[model samples]
Target: MPVTDITTDPQSLTMTLTAEFPAPVERVWKAFTDPSQLERFWGPPGWPATFGDIDLTVGARVQYRMTSPRGERSSGSWEFLSIDEPRSFEVIDSFVTDDGEPLDGFPAMRMTFEFHETPEGARLVNTTYFDNADALEQVVAMGAIEGSRMAMAQLDAVLQDLREYAEGKGTRVELLDDTHVRITRLVNGPRELVWRAHHEPDLIRQWMLGPDGWEMTECVATTTVGESYRNSWAPVGDAEGEPFGFEGEVLLVDAPRRAVTTERMQGMPTETLNDLNLYEEDGATLVTVLIEYPDKETRDMILATGMADGMESSFQRLEREVLTAARP
Candidate 1:
């Protein structure tokens, strides 16, 4: 219902959709940038979406899939071209195979989303440029226009309740698939500080501790793409639990924004890929960690160990001890 106009211009080889929302541009922008909120309305009615490997930075690629009521699935991807926080972003959108490659015979399109404040609230102008008139006609014939309308129609509810969706939610976890899990927490700190706390050994020792009475005995942190890092912790002063540690090699690094690593318990042969992403809005940073397990059994075993609860403790400590003290 938020959609006010939908137009296709053959001469321009483009399709555009305009919609208005009763929310500020910042809130509207978050709904699109945050994978959690984006997934809620990105898919049409019965077809819900699940996003994976989402990094909103320019040059990053995001993969997602929409599942139909009858269990049919369609995969897609976005290659980010540009981003101007809270205002606009552009991406190359394409229908992709399960492996994330563009499907044969399906042409990719350039899509730009612009957000502007209006007297009523905010307005979004989304335009998609096809390679040719034939491409535009092809998409329209395949229900692109109708699908977009239905998708945008669901945005109103998302915008209306975004606060309830994000605020005060401590460390939260979502089982993305049989082998993937996403954990998110909104830390009361800026992205730069959060990123530093993650990479700086001294700062990390202060808050990365899960519970009281545990101390990080070893903190060998690294940011180099090919470098390996290790962390070890031991309980102190009658505290229970054995000393344990994790080791991993950095796979990707985008300073203050995103990082990916292969992590595993020390001496364990199995490893999981961890993708960490940070996004800041209005001073508070949203930390999202996507973990890919080797299999469903490993995924279940890890979750059963109350991993999210321990992470919640660490996040709380991070804000209470490190972030608050660092702020002016």
Candidate 2:
């Protein structure tokens, strides 16, 4: 039988998961706040991590594009709210891909994670609220529990890393917790040049390619959210890419900041909600992307694959293009 923590009540459904980490409260807290530390431990089993424009703080937002073991990428957002050092924090997580591109209908989640102090270590709690009984039952029936256990197994690996590195050659730890997959980059060039790179479809075309051989051979984005578009590409060499490769539907577009929210397929075709933002820092503009996968497994896969490294590499490519294409 599958293990789902969700329980049925009268009107709505609730899911709660609890786990204890064999580490001091303070160190655990640091892992939660620091972007670098958090990245090390954020995925499910068999998936490592790939981060994107990661800037974490109160009201500070970041984006992530992760790839699973099966070569699938999923994206999502983290809108931060409360920050109590390493004790607790809150955020409204949207499981969306860069595309609004469509996988049935999933609403955003308001999740509150609390940390409690224990004599041996610390206890972490995850609580989620569902709209109705049916929704609660529907998701629970969809392998939520089994998926969470796998994610926690991954978390254990993260804690071990922390004990090995941060806590120094000093602590022995084991972290057990379960949760769903609710899941980096840089760019160069002057402000104006960066701005132009994003505005022009021709320039955007140069670096948004997937893997090495996958290219966006065909895309039909009509501008802004609400509007929809499709992109198709084929893999190069011997790699047999995911089943589908036609996706990317606009969700939100912030022109001034050059930020956009989208629903994209699994780097293939399956609606995943996601968002991307381009910002100017000093004289150069930095682009950050976030993706939300629909399941724990998908999220874990994307994270473990070094999505951030891939995006940064793509941006480097974009930066060179901008410098080369700028009015010289």
Candidate 3:
């Protein structure tokens, strides 16, 4: 697929995605279980993922190395948390730094993979748990969005392969003014599901994030027009963490794949984000999120905060998930 080279501030963050697959439960399950099959699709794409010694049992240890185009090797290990043959599994995924030192940052990602049978094929659901908001924020700030979008772009990148796929459409930052920055993306799910993704408390826990150790204490959004709601997002170990993010509000909710605006009480200003989900030629639905910030500060803040790179990266990640979930 055509890759999107996402660049970011490495501090402010972006990228959040979710997808559904049309393939069977058993097939999708194997893609995760069998190292060989998983390796075929995993990694940064166009890059190499060398699956070394892999042991799939629970509490088992495995070492895998991924080499970038520059031939730099990054190694990570996986510890199985829970596993059900051809069903579901969970694991704590982390990277091992050179000199054998354990790096305690971004690589410390946890994931829960699930496979469910459907009339046509199977449903694959991957819920990635964060170590804390800091890592989540860092990755978001770094290149999560661009990375995922690049991965998802692979779908159109390759046409002959019959495999899984996912995507989180590009965001629209309608330069609202000199003080605000508008941002939005299209999600490939029903309006209810998409709405729930942003509004539901339990669902928000899985996708929203903050600084490495920070966790969202609460996200209460009122899905109504003119009825405002507040969301409390902060560092885990320290609720009142630095760069306090005690903010967030919903201005309008256009049910079934559409939201009008958003506001950050103290951190950032307000924006009108129009999120839309539509269909493509091949029967796949495409999502489009359009946002308009209130003024120049927000716009400048977003740009200065590495908005372009971060948004691009988030798009890439969403692309990856979309391709994976869209596969039949």
Candidate 4:
């Protein structure tokens, strides 16, 4: 087990757990921040977790549900209170209803996660402060201690395999559910430059094109919430494809980190919610886009169109034609 010690202090109404891992602090941090890796071990043995789009910035909320083998589900939410990347973060942790309302009688707790470098590798110090002794006792009676131990134990495999998981994998797509899909790509560039590439028209036109013989005919990009942006592309020379375009209104924007938008093909009524997140490690950024469709039909229809393959092509061009040139 990764956990070396667990202690509770009724006087302070706090519980603390110390765990060590044989990995760098940054790698351990990513295991918690990335939803894909987090879901693998956030729940105990028979209970598996499913997380929503996780925004690690302060004031953002994250929701997740852990379902038991018997199909019972426990939902929770975390409101980020503060963040210091690769070092520590604090959150208001609460047992919540499916719609995210706090569950009655289950008081919320203040939780802090601290990461430190050790001679062997890295160490994680997790402390949770309750409002009172009763609150802390209630959580312990609910199997929090045993569950947490099992959950943290599972992190070892994740930290050990992250490199193998991402290395050499181009753009990849995963069906998250009936109506949601997640796409991820790792590019050799910084997060700021990658975010700019998506917003600045001049930079976008250089690499947003999916394949050769295509050119961006029009590009209108925006970062302000509620503002609409449009992008259209057409074939050049002897290229064999009709003109196509996409338009969307920005729902949220946190520069260099995350963005959310509503996207639709021009003249189409159906739309998808796109949540874009960027995380940088060792000078390279991992781009993750979670898309929510109106229904399974819409999700399946879009995937059938070779969308992932086209995205891979564009990402390759993005590295070769844009990011490389921007790097010093």
Candidate 5:
């Protein structure tokens, strides 16, 4: 299951649930906001919720109804208190009648949802706060914990489907030779813009960051045929550890067209050869990367380290921060 932890704080009358999903933050936010998508996984097993009157803005009210196998029905309403897009939201949840009237003496809780980015994908932390211990216990007695687990499991399935659908229409990575792996993507900007972003130190620093909290400490870009370049990065908050960095020698340069270099990281034992080719297609750029390792075993070992995911994330950052600005 994707849910990693669930805890109830009796003193605070709150329940906290943490779950991780192998999907981008934006997609997870969509699943929460889109009513059709929510209906797919919004209830426990054997009972599907039908959502209606969904208004996601602050102060808006949303309604949903769930039916049991024995023809029993339960309805609920949510009054959105705060909304922070693609990140977090707060809402007041309460039981309601079929006609949308509140149920007297029933349990009501304040729910908060927080979405954070992780290396693998995203993590969602949900907390429900009750007015008192009695209110919290009342919801637990109604099978809230088990129902939530089942609903989150259904969300995992939905995320898997989204991933499969994306894989069918995304960038292509392929093996070209015993020593070479080729990655190809159709970038949004023109060839010149893409080339500049790769060859300019200022541009590289903007998009070549490591994860969210790390920034490039130094960037030296030398794009000549025989010159060299070096780059280093460190975590933003702390400067105690040795910085991670890479240095490379340019072997071939064909301005805005193709470049080949030999690169070696500070800690990696094997030096690799990288060839970047940019082509202009329909006013956009098609970027192709060919990385040559020492041997097939060395290439497999590097691939096994899950380097592709980091590379993919860097590419996305480049598109979002550099290419978007370069777009004409």
Candidate 6:
């Protein structure tokens, strides 16, 4: 992660900022060009920008508004002057009224954005020029530096999410049927490494805990058909809450590719059918887990418990513990 650096030069009547993202140049470029992505981080932390109109073509106008915490609104417009894909672009930006009219006597800026490739990742440079030095000083007095820094920090978070998704460390839940949920992701390792991580109790204990403040106390797994497995977990400290555990019987097993099991939690009302399917693509492993509940109501209730978030935390750990360890 890189902190955004902002500098203003009185001699040149310009303010320049630079930030780095841990992603490919092309992906980083898309974050600026894509309206959805831009909307996620275009404003300061609390004031989120909403793009009402976006036209990236030369001479086209773009309009957006940012709402404050107190419900106050600020509008702005940008007219694109030039664009070179994945490299650079220039726009004329200014404050505007609700009716899309530029504010009288307010300073307008010519902004250029440049993307550069680096060994670590992508570097973005933003240069904003004012017609005169007085305008530059006026905007700085309005807290422009602090605001841009906060907005760039938000962009850092957005980049992290995009990278996690691309590496298959993100969880995706799909409703395959009325009673079944299919969660699939590309795990960043070979089939054998991922299989071992799941089967080995020590390795499973490393990443199976859903989120912070919880840990698996005991784990027992067997891959042979007809064998039974058990797991126990509880909060990390004090352990005052009810313990969570599950018992399951393996119904089908195929080395590193597939497995079917039936599991019941100690205090849960229903038993679930679990199927694990694995596929190899390039050097990575694709994992698909299907869990079937007794009825639609049960499935919906479980999904509403924010189960996907816990799975996301677990898989993110798996990427570090299993995939990164297996890297050649």
Q: What TM-scores do the predictions have?
A: 0.60, 0.44, 0.41, 0.60, 0.50, 0.51
Tens digits of per-residue lDDT for model 5 on 160-205?
Answer: 5533433324356677557878676666677898999899988998
Query: Worst lDDT window (10 residues) for model 4?
Result: 159-168
> What are the C-alpha RMSDs, in order, of all predicted structures?
10.0, 12.5, 20.8, 10.1, 19.8, 15.9
Instruction: Write model 2 residue lDDT over 215-307, tens digit each, in one string.
Output: 667656555656666655667678666534445555444464433444555355545555443444445444434455667666666556665
Please give, for residues 1-328, the per-residue lDDT of candidate 4 as tens digits. 7999988999989999999998999999999888878887798754557789989889999999886523467999989999999999999999999999999989899999999999999999999999988999999999899889978976865786434546479888877568878798888888899999989999999899987789999999999888999999999999989999999898867677667889999999999988787767667777878788999999999999888887888999989989999878
As a whole number from 0 to 100, the lDDT of residue 132 in candidate 6 is 98
Tens digits of per-residue lDDT for model 6, 114-151: 99998989999999999998899998998889788767
Candidate 2's C-alpha runs over 4 A off are: 1-12, 99-104, 161-328
- In model 6, the runs with Cα more than 4 Å from the true position are 161-328
Model with the higher TM-score, candidate 4 or 6: 4
Rank candidates by TM-score, best first: 4, 1, 6, 5, 2, 3
What is the alpha-carbon lDDT of model 4 when measured against the actual structure?
Answer: 0.86
- Candidate 5 has an lDDT of 0.79
Better of 3 and 5 by TM-score: 5
Candidate 5 matches the true fold with a TM-score of 0.50
Per candidate, the number of residue pairs that clash is 0, 38, 67, 0, 0, 0
- Relative to the true structure, how large is the alpha-carbon lDDT of every model? 0.85, 0.54, 0.51, 0.86, 0.79, 0.79
Considering only N, C-alpha and C atoms within 3 Å, which residue pairs clash in candidate 4? none
Scored against the true structure, residue 324 in model 4 reaches a CA lDDT of 93
Cα TM-score of candidate 3: 0.41
Off by over 4 Å in 4: 1-106, 109-164
Instruction: State candidate 4's TM-score.
Output: 0.60
Alpha-carbon deviation at 97 in model 3, angstroms: 2.3
